[model samples]
Target chain A: MKRRDFLIGAAATGAFTAAPHIWRKDTSLARASNGEIKVGVLFSLTGTTGIIEESLNKATLLAIEEINDAGGINGMKIVPVVEDPASDPATFAVKARKLVVGDKCVSVFGSYTSASRKAVLPVFEKRDNLYWYPTLYEGRECSKNVIYTGAVPNQQQDEFIPWLVEKFGKKFYLIGSNYIYPKEENNYCKKLLEELGAEVVNEEYVPLGHSEFSSVINKIQSTQPNVIFSTVVGDSVVALHRQYRAAGLDPDKMPMASLTTSENEVAAMGGDAAAGHFTSAPYFMVHQSPENERFVEAYKSRWGGDKVTHFVSEPSYFQIYLFKQAVEQLAASDIDPTTIREAVKGQELIAPQGKVHLEAENLHTWLWPKIAMAKSDGQFEVLRDSKEWLKPEPYAAYPNQHCTADGLVQS
Target chain B: MEFFLQQIMTGLSIGSILLLIALGLAIIYGSMGVINMAHGEFVMLGAYGAWAMNAFFGVGLLPSLIVVFLGVGALGWLVERGVIRFLYRRTLDTILATWGLGVMLQQMIRLSAGGELRYVEMPSVLTGTVGILGVDVPGYRVFIFVFVAALFAVTWYLMFRTTFGTKLRAVVQDRSVASCFGIDADKVYSLTFAYGAGLAGLAGALVAPLKSVSPEMGTTYVVDAFFVVVLGGVQSLFGTVASALMLGELTGGLAYLWNDTIAKALVLLAIIVLIRFRPQGLFVSRIRS
Candidate 1:
């Protein structure tokens, strides 16, 4: 045999030998008998987003455990196949493809970024599989194959702009990490702010993962805007907050709000620095609801009482339940991909955040957003919340706005 | 015009950081002909050392800088004596080994710091702004620019005007010849590596207050340092400093007009064009084989 063929044969033999050894002996051969359904849980477990993803994964597992215990989704156990993407977008797509095509999962709930979700979009589209993305992203993309359970721009920025104008007046400073999400979000924010009579003092973009903010902080101080509107992501937010505090700028005096900062950031930034900051998201740990209380208690019980849960974690937790509901409703008769997709679009469930409805037209969810003021203990005190679930306007319908309703489609 | 000047100043401050990092790399590569891929890790170590000093000893910025410099210098010496000495003749092996070392060091840092960005407090005196000509500039950046320039002068004097410097140059010129003449080439090489690594650590400690302290922060500067070294000529210190400043200015000025991604792409394109014209770099001796 040629060298290549010999190498391939050797690799195949090695894999065959290793497979049995690595396989768990306790693996139950008792497969799903009648109405059981399997869903995939894909999250980053070992990379940059590991800490947050770990909490999300715990929440998801907790939800699954609770569902399974409570009659197992219409008397059939809801099985979750967990996969780690290792915080790589490409890996997310690969794992997503395998979950849908190989594992034959009814639905896949995954992704933490627009990039990661975008990576798996094509895979989901090609297979016409249902993907429930749990992270808030740039609003302008809607798709049939995906259910965006997170807040879109209109769900977030629409209320944010009017509220800021009413509370803080008309001057804003726009700062964000340089990426498609931040850039697009900031652009929409600026346009909205302008239309609402707010003047953007200055707009700045820094490289993602950039931590230095002395220069930018200096610029902000000089500009002295009414408020700072930020779209910065990840650990960069921690750096920005630290620098802002070090510069001696009081958040109360010249308040800054972010579209990105959530309970996760407050935990990372610690209570002292992140306190008094304003942030908008669809969920908060301190939401006063029976479902939310149960979620908080269960999450704390499973992932340690000291671990802080965030908006993203709650939504991710809800996605698994949503998937469970869809599978049970559809899987009783069939367990094919098409049925799962249809079931997901048609499913509506009471989540911890609130009652969320998946829009059949766009596959985006209608959920209410809460504006919270951060307390000293790294938790939010809900200052204001929408009384009703805001209908997801995925496509922009306004004539003056640059985007349209069709522009929001993801695929 | 004021905005343009302010951007230039900002670029210069940023370039000073690149210069400090590239200076260490150029010295090690010049003296030993080994590409110390772990140079960025040394810088990272220095930042951590400063953080540790603050955590343990309660040292402020000035004292912490000194502590990190000496601490990381000792670490560099230990690394050279314990690990780097064995792979002197094999350049590729040294590069690969140091790359592994870098990864190990970063992971160790991650295990300790937990992958979150932490802030190092800047000295009160260095906080605020200064008027430069007609424009307002950050006081910390102005301090950095002045400090790096003084550091460059001191390094230049030490390399060209001292006995140790003479021995270091002798080794770089001809190691076998210098050894035959009774010069302790190995000792010089080890000391040079330590000193170069120490400088890198100093740069890291100095910039920690200005940037976030995380395990992977060093990776960001390492790529830019490579470009600076390659563009400046590997063996020429002056060339590294000049090119680093020029590249920083170009990128910083353009960032004001365009997005940061496009600015970086433009810098990379300029470097590519430069390479096509001058393969030996702008300053290195073109010795034909």
Candidate 2:
């Protein structure tokens, strides 16, 4: 009788532990069958990258609210299950699993850094879920599970490097925050510089969030590079900019051109420090167009009057519209991730940047790249506009590698 | 010769900042033995205080320093009275509890301040570069070196020359005996914690114009501050100053020779080896129990 009691106790404990999972599965099924579609909003609301990721989160939510208010996808309300991974890549993977397998979200929109995206990649692939990634990245990846709405290395650096060499000088100093994104971007920049017979004076990477830049400033001054091409992100951007100015490095003589320093960073670094710097991106807050104006107005009104839009947030805002258009094309009962991805392949939207189209072959967006100089009031002054949208080459640095509809291909 | 001088200048600048950041932790952890893990949050609060003053009331960073210090010090007093006073005897619990408090403080700031990066404007007078020993250094950096020296002197006087410092040191040495001898040990501990937190606030306000002011900014400083305190001997204030400069020069020299990543790894490795040889740290306290 005692042995039987022990067995019963073990069985009860097992059932208790598994109860939450079973309940969650039942709710997921019921919600899917109901007149609502669920998607996960995974963005870091706190931690090191929270400064930028919070804006991205706000942008995603604004898009979702707009869609629902205008009547979401064939009269079906899109339910967003938001989660904060707190800027840790390991946490991102865990949250992705919960969103995919536990909450049963058909799609998720998230990630700011390349590290976070790489961490979550396997989860979506294994679970056959879609992830809408809207950050400009290192661009060597090709995944069917992700819809890439941001610019690739080629779209950003193809015209940016040559223009800098022609206007500034042949000598370039490359500095960035130590990470996959900056290293990869620098590699592409090196390849382009080699083709143009430009000299790389020095290349350096500091740990992320490193605020001390005196040594870096000393190096830049000693080397005297004509153009400092910086890919530093997060708090390091502000530190480097302020330190550079403090070291009396004139941006006019040898301006620091960057791919990552947006209006958000400028606002943090203070406009005076960023006044003469340049940045290359697909969008800027000052980009003049009716679509951009409306989007900016709507964003500020919804978020606050002080909130400003930038490159990453622009893509974050537009990708939801793209998702909505794709969802509109799908049948009411067949809104699975696979069908949604198929429907989204060739979708087009008049985004704040301009008219953008999702490439059917590679699943990356074609975007118009612009180079802008930061003004004293924390706004980008447009200097050069790529009149035509540039196609994304995910493997632009590798001559033989290409991203196709099937997968990454090499010849 | 110029390159070497430039590197030394960079090292001095780095060392000054490290000293400013680590001084507060040395006081809190050295005297109290509370293992206050929320020291970084105190620094964060100070930076936010400066930003708030500038953003809302048009007050500059210099004038806001005193306000931030007092405000953050009061917060420290509350924390001591509310959570830390009870856990004084339990060192491990204090660590855990303070860590949890740190997380709570970070989330609280994020919710209130909206997590976006905020900037502090540098004074116009300190904007230009100054030539020292034929090496051009920022005027602000030179100011930091002088300011930190003055601050350290003041802290040193407060800890050694004052009657309150005498009572605090007596309590730190023997809490029960000091309590029996008419020293209110609780008040000493509370005031000590508040003073340390106030120093951290001052450090944060001073560095606000140099770095980005955000919620997570404190985490970066706290790690380095802990390193300085550990390597310098937790009980020795002079040791903290010595170690900060040594680490600064070592990093600057090694980074100039190679790169930042290898330099950091080597510095950390050196610290580990040194700690293994001298577990009590570089400066051993002669205070008897």
Candidate 3:
């Protein structure tokens, strides 16, 4: 046989030998002798979303490195199997499958977008594995195999809308990227506005990666809304803010209040355009706490002094410790998806954002919400912070729908 | 009536940006029939060049445009000479190869600069607004309109009124015949490609302040630029301008009436219908061979 055929035969034989090890119901048994726990790190290192997701990847790695350096969890070093999904949802599913099935990671920590999370959901569910998601997203999902360590609508928008209405005015203009996250956010905003008898001047959605915002700015000018509630993400965030500034709209009169605008976007938008705009999030890099101080210091030292942390990266960093805490609660050999899921429940970490609890009932994190205004120096000034950790209510708008320990419950 | 003028002004500003992006593609694909898929990457390089000049050397955006143009234009020349030169006639292969080149450029930039958003500060002089017809228009946008017009005039002069223009057009029409006339078709094509790439770089530099400078930012511009170029007759420069303005006005008008998402859908539908009926596009060239 030729060399190609011979290599193919050898690969086939190697696969046949590795089959039993992979096919085992509990693949952890196969790696018992290694003294190292394998986990997967799935983040888009390249593509349209890579600009933001790259920071998330660095944060996840920084956490993993810190854990390994600190003697690790029960003497087993976490070996992260890093994979780049390249910002595509289909690729996210493929990489997720590789992490759960091929590498047999005890758990996978990844995904910044709702689309990516939804894509990887089936992979974790089918294999009965755990996946830790770290990003503030549109709520309404309750997956047993996924630990949501990000803020939902209640954690972000619940007190935010009332505060905005009180501070700004009754008239609001809603603008967002044409995606599920923004659409759902607008839905929740509308629901809250209806409750408060606030008027929605107009609502508009732009396609993702849309850079031109002249027309949209015109609409905002014409409408003359007191506050602009925006859910625009990615490159569009920078474009919208700059164009809004260019159109001579004063943020003091009608600031663009957003759930998506973070330090990362502000850095891109420049201080002039982003100044006076407000962002509602669970965490800002400038949050005053010992944990945050250490986190910012460490992240800067590790990634470089210029590297900035945002709301999502904070969760990406802390969720690893939550995992370590969860795993340490159980014996080495006794660890698996079901046991770890139970242990990870109710696990609380003093994250940079502050004391956060992984909700026992729904596998979602309870985070401290805060409202901040972007300063001209590319940082946020915290205006209001929740006095306590807000519980994660995944289905806040749909009053009849609830995510319980058993699963989603609908009346 | 004021709102209508404001809408029209906004449309014109949007159209100016579209023209900035499409002018380069029109020069390359329109004249040469070579599908320059890496054109967007050329734009991306220009943005990065602006950022680098600002970050490392303290060169302002306006001052850095000349350097960015030459730098990106030189790289375009290298690409045309090394790879695109050999595959000039093979349209399908050029598309695939250039697309691969675009991807390579993106990855290369990501590795070098790190995949984070970079900001370009707008000139202080251009930060204010200009009032026209009782509407306050952004000074930077007004500058763009004037700059695009000047660039278009220069490009037009080069294509129609210069010796290089005659030679380039002759080479494009019949490479063999141009070679027989001692025009050096290879030289004309390479310079044409470089100039087109340079125009794209100029567009990118001008836009860097308005949009975030990132590796993938070019992808956003490229798609819209293609729409403008195709909807305008691929061979006609005036057609590109007309289509860009028309699309801009349509989008602005429709978006004002309804929403952005619907406006984009309708504009796209209109383009599709127009393309189906008139494949040669809105303007048909009457030049005889």
DockQ of each: 0.18, 0.56, 0.59
CA RMSD of each candidate after superposition: 7.3, 5.6, 5.6
Among residues 3 or more apart in sequence or in different chains, the pairs in candidate 3 whose N, CA or C atoms overlap within 3 Å are none
The residue pairs found clashing in candidate 1 are A140-A408, A141-A408, A142-A408, A142-A409, A142-A410, A395-A405, A396-A404
- DockQ winner between 2 and 3, please give it: 3
| Worst window of 10 by summed lDDT in candidate 3 chain A | A24-33
lDDT, model 2, position B261: 77
Please give the CA lDDT of all the candidate structures: 0.78, 0.90, 0.91
TM-score for each predicted model, relative to the true structure:
0.84, 0.90, 0.92
Provide the lDDT at A209 for model 2: 78
Report the lDDT tens digits of candidate 1 across residue range A145-256.
Answer: 7878888777877777788878877889888998888777777787788788889988888878866565576567667888898888877888788667655678876777
Local error of candidate 3 at B10, Å?
1.3
Off by over 4 Å in 3: A1-35
Candidate number achieving the greatest DockQ relative to the actual structure: 3
Q: How does residue B175 of candidate 1 score in lDDT?
A: 79
Order candidates by lDDT, high to low.
Answer: 3, 2, 1
> Residue A21 CA error for candidate 3 (Å)?
11
Could you give candidate 3's per-residue lDDT for residues B1-289 as a string of tens digits? Answer: 9998999998998899899999999999999888988889999999999999999999999999999989998998898999999998899999999999999999899899977777788888998899998999999999999999999999999999999999988888888988999998888988999999999999999998888888878777888899999999999999999999999899888988887889889999999999999998999777676
If the candidates were sorted by their DockQ against the true structure, best first, what order would they fall in? 3, 2, 1
- Model 2 chain B: worst 10 consecutive residues (lDDT sum): B254-263
What is the CAPRI rating of model 2's predicted complex?
A: medium
